[model samples]
Target: MKQRVVPIAVLAGALFAVNVVARLITRFGFDGDDTAQYRITIGMFATIGVILASVAYVRAQKSLPSEWLPSLAAAAIGGMLLTILVGPFLSGGYPFSAGAGNFFSQIWLYGGFAIVGILFGYWIATMLGRDYRSQSLKAFTAAKAGKPRRVVRR
Candidate 1:
């Protein structure tokens, strides 16, 4: 439990930290500039994607998909919640200050980007034949090829 929770919590906190940094930049540097705020938000999302993608690539190398995927999902959700709920306060705004539609859109965007990043990482790992499943399959094939087949009387 500790092993699982600690990594997930750390990933979530990292994601939220990115949001805080973005918020602070926007609040201080572009308080009244809508264009700058939009650009910063997009940049924030891309940074989140890259972070998740790199983590996914590394985790895939170390653990089975069955073991790592759920934890990844949990971390993504935890991160999204922190970004959407606690982030606004740091920027002197409320969660729903932009209205419900914007709030929900943020959720959708976060989930979508997270999925895309994970998929991209998984694809790269698979292509490199370095992911857990690929390595296990390779080992199984090698072991099978090493053994001689027995002749059966028909």
Candidate 2:
């Protein structure tokens, strides 16, 4: 359990770090520029999505989705909370300075991206017939089809 948790926490921290880097760049490099801020935010979201998707893809190769999905979700949620709440302080701003709408919006955006990332990864795995469920189904069908048929007397 410790081994699993350490890696998950590390991954979550890494994801949060991406947000921190984006925030720093936006604050310092694009001060007072709404256009740049918007683009940076979108790019940050995409980066997180790509990270989640890659993690899912790699995990799918050796484990079932059920085994890793919960951990990934927990990590995402944890990292998101830190990014939204603690992140502002690093920029010398209050967490609620942006108002409740902004706070909730961040949550929604993060969650939506995480979900989409996981779905995209799983979809690709299924298409490639590499996911656990897909492989199991394939093997089951093959086994059934390969069995000899019984003949009935008329």
C-alpha lDDT score of every prediction, in listed order? 0.92, 0.87
lDDT by residue for model 1 over 6-25, one digit each (tens)? 99999999999999999999
What lDDT would candidate 1 get against the real structure? Answer: 0.92
C-alpha RMSD values across all candidates: 1.7, 2.5
Candidate 2 on 1-154: residue-level lDDT in tens? Answer: 8978997899899989999999999899998999998899889988998899888877786679889998988888888888898988876787888899988888889989988987888788878988888778888999999999989899
Candidate 2 contains a number of clashing pairs equal to 0
In candidate 2, the residue pairs with backbone N, CA or C atoms under 3 Å apart (3 or more residues apart, or in different chains) clash, namely none
Report the number of the highest-TM-score candidate: 1
Total backbone collisions for each predicted model: 0, 0
Q: List the residue pairs that clash in candidate 1.
A: none
